[model samples]
Target chain A: MEEVERLQHYFQVLSDVNRLRIIKFIDKEKRSVSEIVKNSSMSQPLVSHHLKVLKNSHLVETQREGPFVFYQLTNPKILDILGLFEEMLPKENLVSDFSPMFCCPSWWGNSN
Target chain B: MEEVERLQHYFQVLSDVNRLRIIKFIDKEKRSVSEIVKNSSMSQPLVSHHLKVLKNSHLVETQREGPFVFYQLTNPKILDILGLFEEMLPKENLVSDFSPMFCCPSWWGNSN
Candidate 1:
């Protein structure tokens, strides 16, 4: 897919918190749909719908184990997506300064 | 903004190709709304609407140069967002193989 299309798809999948949590969980380890429901505190059908969206975007993939289906982050490129946000957005860090580097030209110059 | 919120807003702005083109142009250098309209093959009102969306998302900012409003990429972090998609997405490169590195475990290990 084109970069814009992929970006749109990534953002569309991320528009929902439920879907974001699903990807985060899957990133930790592959899990079945029911497990996602337990962790996300959302309905099974809702989880299934969100998974379908993720799958369609190619952000995730599924594997069937007997009667259960397991979902995993098939695309490692999502790390770049998450890392992009991590690098751009501000975060709260207890032990250190959590300010974003992009705010300063010096940081940008050094990093680049 | 929070990463999820930022992601949603970025995606929402990017969902329209008109807005995407606006950002891409601004990324190259600051340009007036009229210049954007000329380059993008879009109408003035349409470009205005799209610029409003981009401004709201904090992806692009504007400066009033006399009678003209010049837009520029204020947030360098958008580079990370764009980089995320570029890394994840498939691109065509005529000179060499443009295959994504994410497809292989070795690439991930090496890059990470």
Candidate 2:
């Protein structure tokens, strides 16, 4: 049943577009909640909810500097997982300008 | 919205314990409904329903041989996806004997 729990946790994490976007942001660079809100369309409360779930599932880890909490992905391989999933999507389903991104690899190189 | 539908689909497919099992069985080899039911703990109706969803999402494909139809994974790359996820499972979460079954490589190698 651990497999069920582990998988259910992961699937639940991946199922939410906000959570996936949060991971993409953290994967790009360690970020505080404010930095995350600045780059992402999600508001403070939605980011908080997704971050809590990602942290509980161990997919993400956090660092604290006095009053600030910075979050980063716990595993780099998760990038590979997300990349593979992106490959599965047809090119047409993605927006032409790639605004309102579902996911992309350039976040790491394009920023920070 | 298309990305939402697509991710919702694949996450929904991978999330269910029974649906993952069906993919495992078919991924091992193309199987008839009876072969699936025989290898899986799910009942006839349940298997039928999961198959419908998987088929709808194109994660699975089926072929007919006279009165019997056989199902198989639509893409082998899905194997790499599942395998990567398996790598993330902690060593202890798995039952030592591996009795209940899960997404495993040997389902293809050990059988048929």
Candidate 3:
């Protein structure tokens, strides 16, 4: 693929709130699907779907250990990018509303 | 807007290839709309549209001097994020295709 198309794909992969949540949740340590499901409101299947997208984009990678598989960011620089965004975040967003907008769509049966 | 929503919008703003091209084109120095049009294959209206989106996202800002409006990145850190993406770009993408991808989808009447 061309570089621009690849970048368009990369940014598109990151365009979702849930995907960003998943990326942040697994940023520090690798997490199994069950662990992610247990800690977050996302269902097991939803977590699996986002994980697949992340993997395909080469943003996240998986490791197998026995029967469980753990997922982690492919590069630590991903966090640096996120950190830059955080730094660039306007003060209005930080203070205007502390509550979350929403979790997964109602159809997904998200627990939160 | 919520932080995640704001970020989602920001990423969406960056997801398009033309927007990315425009961002890169204006990265080093601020440029007037006509200058951008003259330098890129994109037309004047399309350049204006992308600049509006970029400005709304706070990724780019504009200045007016007499008859010209100059657009430039709001923060240099935006380039840092792009640099990170470049670093993370796979070797396959860099080496696989040397030809230009279709510019402006052929419908935009791009000169190139």
Candidate 4:
């Protein structure tokens, strides 16, 4: 039941575009609130709210270094979820063919 | 971009507990709107609305068998997504240990 709840919560957290963007951004490296705000072009409050949701969902974990809170993907376990999604969802041959969207390095970095 | 849209749409469709329950039901066998409504204890209109959303998302496809429209999981492709999610998410040992939640047979059937 806890696992179900966690999975449900994770899915809910991923449902938002902003949160998904945040996850995508943070996928590269741990980021402070301001950095995420800058990259996502979302309001601080909105980002904070989504971060709270992500935190509660266990999709992300925060570390306070000095005055800044650095947010990072906590559970590498969720990568399995992303992996499953990649396999299950329709694969874009164009993205994979021309670009390296499915490639490990590109997918793991913010270069794409 | 189409693939991303489809994935996002599918995730959005799965976000709802009611929709998830509906999908879980249809996973076993194709079900009519009325049967889904009865099993889920939700209203016909609500079920119809969800089915429409699921259909639009390509998570579930409908077949008009006689007068009754039967809904079934359209893209077995989404199963790969589910598989990736299972790998990424925290594994429930209890569910897998005692019962066979992760097993193919039980997962494909209506039986718990």
Candidate 5:
């Protein structure tokens, strides 16, 4: 693909709220599909679908540990892009920064 | 719109190649529609359409000087975002940085 086309595809893949949320959830550390679904409050199928798109775009990658699959960002530079976007946004539009969680969503009472 | 939705829309607006081209053209200084059309080699209507979308998204702001309208980026931080993206891109996929030109494309040997 041409340089412009690849960038257009990358931006298109990033043009989703759910995908951004999922990306943020998995930024600092790898997470299982269930963990992403739980943190994002998105359905398992939907989370998986977004993960597939992210992986296809080379924005994300995965590893297998036993029966579990872990997904992580392919490049840490993605976080830098996200940070720039956040900086451009209005303060009111800002969300709290992602804090990686090892425990279940219910156990934390929705701090994410 | 919600924060996520607004961000999604922002990214969606940025997902187009022409829009990115136009944004880069107007990054440092304001340029008239005719100027953009000349540099982009895009039709007048297409350039106008992309400019309208960018204006609507608050990505580009317009100022009228007599009969001609000039567009400039709303924030300079956008360049930082573009810089980060360029850094993340493969070396072969990268394009030369924009050098603002006051003359017609033919006046120079397509150095841009």
Candidate 6:
């Protein structure tokens, strides 16, 4: 159950576009907060918050150099998860392509 | 952008514990609403609602047999996503074993 909570929290954090973008910022190389803001539309505070969430999820790691903090991926395997989820998402199965074969408005199994 | 919404919605629904359990029910074989309710502690309406969400995500499909409705997985590929995410979740990386490698509270890259 604890593992379930951890996984759900991980997905919850990744469900945000901003957070995904932050991952992209460092996907190629380690980035300082300043570098991310320079390339991304997110403000400093927002970037900081997103990074904290990402770090807490272990999706990324941070290194401190004097006053500069550099953020890079802690779990590179997360890239595989993100990439696979994107690839498997019901891309073609959007509403336009999806329809029930013969769904019932009610299933009689529930008598209670 | 549309794909992003679809993926996010899919994850959002899956982020729930109940929904995940419903998925488990239908994952192995087709189950009528009553079958799910009979076997699981969930109420009928709750099972139905979760099924609708699953169906909308193309994670499950429905078919009618005479008067009985059967719910089954529409996209078996989703199993891989679930399995992979579970495997990749910071299971070992959980805070019990995780420690900061010298991260700063601030990232200097973001000025704005």
Candidate topping TM-score: 6
**Which is the winner by DockQ between candidate 1 and candidate 6?**
6
Across all models, the iRMS values in order are 9.5, 8.0, 6.5, 9.6, 9.4, 4.9
TM-score of chain B of each: 0.69, 0.72, 0.75, 0.66, 0.75, 0.75
What's model 3's overall lDDT? 0.74
Tens digits of per-residue lDDT for model 1, B1-112:
4555544544555655566667777775889999988998888998887786666555666888799998888776676566656666533321111222334565566421
lDDT of 6 by residue, B1-112 (tens): 4655665666676777777777766776888889988878889998888777777667887888887789987777777677778887765554332234554455755321
Residue A82, candidate 6: C-alpha displacement in angstroms? 1.5
Give candidate 1's total backbone clashes.
0
- Residue A72's C-alpha lDDT in candidate 1? 87
lDDT of each: 0.65, 0.69, 0.74, 0.66, 0.75, 0.72
Please report how far candidate 3 places residue B11 from its true position, in Å.
1.9
* Greater-DockQ candidate between 1 and 3: 3
TM-score winner between candidates 1 and 5: 5
| Model 3 lDDT per residue over B1-112, tens place | 6666777767777888898888888887989999999988988998888787776566777888889999888876777677667667543432222234545775788531
Ranking by TM-score: 6, 5, 2, 1, 3, 4
Clashing pairs in 4: A77-B88, A80-B84, A80-B88, A81-B85, A81-B88, A84-B81, A84-B84, A88-B81
Docking class of 1: incorrect
DockQ of 2: 0.13
Candidate 4 lDDT score at position A77: 54
Q: Please report how far candidate 5 places residue B14 from its true position, in Å.
A: 1.0
Off by over 4 Å in 4: A1-7, A90-112, B1-6, B77-80, B83-87, B90-112
Model 6: residue A90 alpha-carbon error in angstroms: 1.8
The sequence of per-residue lDDT tens digits that candidate 5 reaches over residues B89-111 is: 43442122222225567556742
Give residue B101's lDDT in candidate 3 (0 to 100): 51
Model 4, span A1-112: residue lDDT tens: 5433444544665766677778778884789999999997899998998887676555677888899999998876555465457566544222332122444665677432
Q: Score candidate 6 by lDDT.
A: 0.72
Sliding window of 10 residues with minimal summed lDDT for model 1 chain A: A92-101
iRMS of candidate 4, Å: 9.6
Best by DockQ: 6
- CA-RMSD of model 5: 15.9
